[model samples]
Target chain A: MQLEVKPKGHTVFVYIKGEIDLQETERLRQEVDRYIDHHGMDHLVFDLTQVNFIDSSGVGGIIGRYRKMKDIGGKMSIVGAKPTVEKVLIFSGIQKIIPLYQTEKDRIKAEK
Target chain B: MNVNEKDFRVKNQIRLTIQSRAENVAFVRACTAAFASQMDYTLEEIDEIRLAVSEAVSNSIIHGYKNDPYSQVELYITLWENGGIEIVVEDHGCGIADLKQAMEPTFSTEPGRMGLGFAFMQSFMDQVEVKSRVGQGTTVILKRKVRQPVESKN
Candidate 1:
């Protein structure tokens, strides 16, 4: 997985691409947490348009990150998950708590 | 031998082994998705395959091995002629003490588990047969027919 950070005003957008499985869970968790701590960004957006697969472990990692961000008064939003990935997220009840946007533009708008 | 019936055909097979971790779920999903795509299965059929495979692998990991990497899960897949496919999932770990309870839809050894894995496989596939014994491990056999749908009467 690749993490690209784009700072647009006060919000920080994190773009994640590739399969987020158990193998990549630790790196992802650590990277996001480090970024949150380092930058002190209030708004976080995730781009999952290129992510093809995610399992329960991956979901757990994301949920963990969301919780950390939430605890620090930061907001996180996800954009562009394919149907398969979306199903797992929805089944795991992650979507109910996190707002999912259909496109990057919409996610940016929500961050505002 | 029937000379006309001797027309040649070829078969394909796929196999995978994964550790008993929640992480393996992605492998299962990717593999099942690839299989479905190769056979041009419909979206509904693809979802069914994903769910069934998930249950099969999850059962092997959770019940058979109990998250012990020392225990290994083996998966064998065969694509046969006449649009038939067979999947054999085996685990060498702690075996189920009661086959009946294990197959029950609501019976689960793991807390928060729905125990719908076997039931889901039965509902989605053409055939599902499980053979298991205490101290002998478990094997789940699943078969599905592609390119054809079971007809239902109105």
Candidate 2:
């Protein structure tokens, strides 16, 4: 998976591409953690618009990160997950905890 | 959890063997996705097959083999003339002690896991069957029936 991190307004937006599975979760976790730590961001945003596939491992990784953000009094949000990836995330029951936005503007509106 | 062979007829088949490794998960996903594309499946249907296969293979590598590179994982895919498909992912690793509990959504024996492998398989596919012997190995069978003349939800 490819990730590009953009730090904006106390939030680190992670744009991920390709697939998120067992092989990519570890690296994604490490990299996102690094960006969160280095940028000292107070919020995390995941841009899954380009991500096509994810499995349980990816869900686990996302939850782990969510916990990390919660521990630090920070927040995380996700935007633009396609129907397929959204199915797995919703089936895992993560939407109950983290906020999911179908578009970038939708998240902005909700946060506002 | 027996997949009665009498339920469907096979028109095409493919079998693959790969060492248990994290990277092979994508390889297996791509191969199965490509194979499913041979049928007149919708993009969403094709994506479901990809996700289910990914979850099964990931379980084999992560849970069964425990990331052991020396172990091998086997996959058997059969295509039905009606655009239906069945896949069996088998692994020779530590097997689950309780199949029912393992299939439970969000129940994971592994630390820091959501344990949604079987959940995803069961949710996206028409049928999911698992057979495992503790300390022996595990096999995951996934099947999806084609919805003929079904158009995309566009």
Candidate 3:
């Protein structure tokens, strides 16, 4: 998996590509956590457009990050989830907790 | 009494064994997804199968083998003549003590785990049956029927 981080004002946009499964969840968790800790961003946005596959472990990693942000009075949102990835998120009930947006522009606009 | 073996036909079958490791999880999924592609499954179906297979293999690597690199995980895929697929993921590691409790959602023995592996398998596939014996091994069987393309009217 590849992760790209871009800081836009108070939010950190994390663009993830490739498959997110048990193999990549630990690295993803560590990277996101480290970035959040260092940047002190108030909002975390995940761009999953390029992500093709995700399993329960991947969902767990996302939930863990969401919890981490929430504990710090911050928010996290997910955008551009493929249909297959969206189904797993919905089935795992992550969609209800984290807002799902179609694009980064929509996510930023919603937060405004 | 002799049974006619010719009466039963096997369409396609494959067996794979890999060391119990996190990296091999994706490999298992990719192999199964590629095999299922021959059935003309939609992208959605393929994703579901991949997810289910990943969960099963992850369970073996994490819970079953407990990160033991020496242990091996076996995967079997069989395509039936009726356009159905059967997948079996087996591991000769620590098995579940209570199958009932293990199948329940949100019942994880490890921290930071959702314990939804079986749930995803059940939700995605038509049938999911688990057989295990503590100190022996565990085998997860998943079956799904491929949707036939709609016939066009001439």
Candidate 4:
């Protein structure tokens, strides 16, 4: 999987491309944490439209990141998860804590 | 696990032995999906099998092998003529002592893990049978039935 970070105002958007399964979740957590630490960016958006698949390990990675985000007194949101991927996320019960949006625009709209 | 005589009639079968590494999880997922696709299963069913297969392989790598990367995970897949499938993922590593607690949702021996592996296997598939011997290994058997293909949702 490939991970890229974009900073817009106070929020950081993470564009993930590829499958987020057991093999790649550790790298995901480490890289995203690095971005958050190095830039000190708070509000985070995970752009998952390009993610092909995700399993429990990926869910755990997201939940682990949420805990870090909470500890830092910040917010995190998920954007553009396909139907299958969305179902896995829901089954893991992470959607109850992290708001999921169809797009970054939708998240911005929800904020207002 | 109840024995069904019909389930013994395997239309197709496959066996694989992979290294106990994280990367092999995706390999197992892809292989299972490809093998199951030969039948009349839908795309969603294929994805479900893929997810369940991934979870089982991940558990072996993380909990069973303890991330040793040198161990082995064997997979036995049987496709029934009636559009049903049985997948067995096995690992010879540290085993679970408390099977009941291990299957509980949100219960994990390792921290930072969701502990939803068994749950996902049980949820996505029709049946999930777990057999483990502490200090010997663990085996996960997943079965699903997709006899009739529904209207394609394209």
Candidate 5:
């Protein structure tokens, strides 16, 4: 998986493309954490439109990052997860914990 | 674990170039679930096997490769002759210093995560084996039996 970070004012947008499974979970977690720590951002959005699949570990990684952002008084949201990847997230109970947006524009609007 | 008269075996292989990270967990989950489905294993058994396989592969990418984007993780799965399964997870990365220490429950190289991958394998699978050497690489072998139990006449 590839994670690209874009700074939008006080929000850090993370655009991830590819499968979020055992192999990419750790790096993704570290990268997200690094961005949050470096920018001290209070809002985060993960773009998963290109993600083909996700698993428990991937779910755990996102949850882990979300908790980190939460503890620091930040908000987190997910945007554009494909059906299969989204199902895994839902199965892992991530949807219950994190809010999902229909589109990137919608996500940006929610951030406002 | 239980044993029954009828048994089946199947082998599946999937290889993809991945920039290793924690997200690989999902791939492992999907693959393992597909494997279990082919074997017709119960949901509980499938879930357990999925978790075990994910933990093993996660160790390979996280500890073995240390999240190197260029490296690849190879997974070979063999469903045995008697409703048993074995998975071989391999990675070309810096090998472990002490096998015993690495398998310890509290010996995680990363923070905020339990050093419990090895321990989880031991608890979840019937057998867990590791082969590694410094500067070479590492391969983790995991096996589990998934059959209905048979009662013997006394």
Candidate 6:
């Protein structure tokens, strides 16, 4: 998996490409957390458009990041989840805690 | 227990044994998804199968083997003639003492781990049965029926 971060004002958009599974979740978690901490971003937008598959481990990793961000009074949202990836998120009930948007522009607009 | 028993008739069966390493989890998922593809399952169904298989194999590696790379986790896939697929992931590592508590959602024994493995398996497959003994091992069996695409009614 590849993680790229784009800073737009106080919100940072993280573009994750490839499958998020047990093999790659830890690296993803570390990279996202490190980027967020270094940039001192107050909000996060996880772009999952290119992610084709996600398992429970991926869900756990996302939730972990959510908690980390929440503890610091920050916000996080997920955008561009494919149907298959969306099913996993919805099934795991992560969508209830974190808002899911169809596109990054929608998520950014909603946050505004 | 006769060799000619009807229950022994499996149209196609494949068994794979791999080390309990994190890298092997993806291999297991890919192999199971490929096997399920033989039934001509839709992409959505195949993704679900892959997710379920990854969860089970991850549990075997993380919880069962405790990240012990030398341990082995076995995966078995069977395709029945009746358009049904069965997958079994087994490990001879540490077994769960309380099966009920283990199956509960969000019940992870370790930090940074979500206890939704069994939940995903149960949600994705038509049937999920887990059998484990404290000292023996754990075996998770998942079954799903594939529907063949119908011809257009032109």
Task: Using DockQ, give the best candidate's number.
Answer: 4
Summarize candidate 6's per-residue lDDT along A52-96 as a digit string, tens digits.
Answer: 989999999999999989988998999999988998999899988
Query: Residue B100 error for model 2, in Å?
Result: 1.3
lDDT of 1 by residue, B1-154 (tens): 2223322232567888877775676677678667655554677667667666767877877688886765677888776544556788888777888888888765778654445567767876789989888877899998776755322111
Model 2: per-residue Cα lDDT at residue B84 = 79
Tens digits of per-residue lDDT, candidate 3, B29-84, equal 98999988877578888888888889999999999999898899999898765566
lDDT, residue B124, candidate 6: 90
Which residue pairs of candidate 3 clash? none
Q: By summed lDDT, which 10 consecutive residues of candidate 5 chain B come out lowest?
A: B145-154
lDDT of 3 at A111: 74
Docking class of 2: high
Instruction: Please list the residue runs of candidate 2 whose C-alpha ends up more than 4 Å from where it truly belongs after superposition.
Output: B1-8, B149-154
What CAPRI grade goes to candidate 5?
Answer: incorrect
Q: Compared with the true structure, what per-residue lDDT tens digits does model 6 show for residues B9-77?
A: 576899999999988888888888877877767888888889888999999988898889999999889
Candidates ranked, most accurate by DockQ first: 4, 2, 6, 3, 5, 1
Sorted on lDDT, highest at the top, how do the candidates line up?
Answer: 4, 3, 2, 6, 5, 1
In model 6, state the lDDT of residue A74.
95
Q: What DockQ does each prediction reach against the true complex?
A: 0.11, 0.90, 0.86, 0.93, 0.17, 0.88
Tell me what TM-score chain A of model 4 achieves. 0.96
- The sequence of per-residue lDDT tens digits that candidate 3 reaches over residues A11-78 is 89999999998879999999999988887878999999999998989999999999999989999999
lDDT tens readout by residue for model 4, B1-154 = 3446854677889999999999888888889998898777889989999999999999999999999999999999998765688999999999999999999999998999999999999999999999999999999999998757333222
Per-residue CA lDDT of model 2 for B1-154, tens digit only, reads 2346743566789999999989998999999988887777889999889989989998988889888888999999998754579999999899999998999887887899888888889988999999999999999999998887332122
TM-score to native of every candidate shown: 0.65, 0.92, 0.93, 0.94, 0.56, 0.92
Candidate 5, B70-133: lDDT as tens digits:
7777777776556667778887888898999998865777765546567667866789989999
lDDT of 4 by residue, A1-112 (tens): 9999899999889899999998899999999899878888679889999998999999999989888889899999999999999999999888899999988789889976
Mind sharing the TM-score for model 6?
0.92
lDDT of each: 0.73, 0.88, 0.88, 0.91, 0.73, 0.87
Local lDDT at B58 for model 6: 93
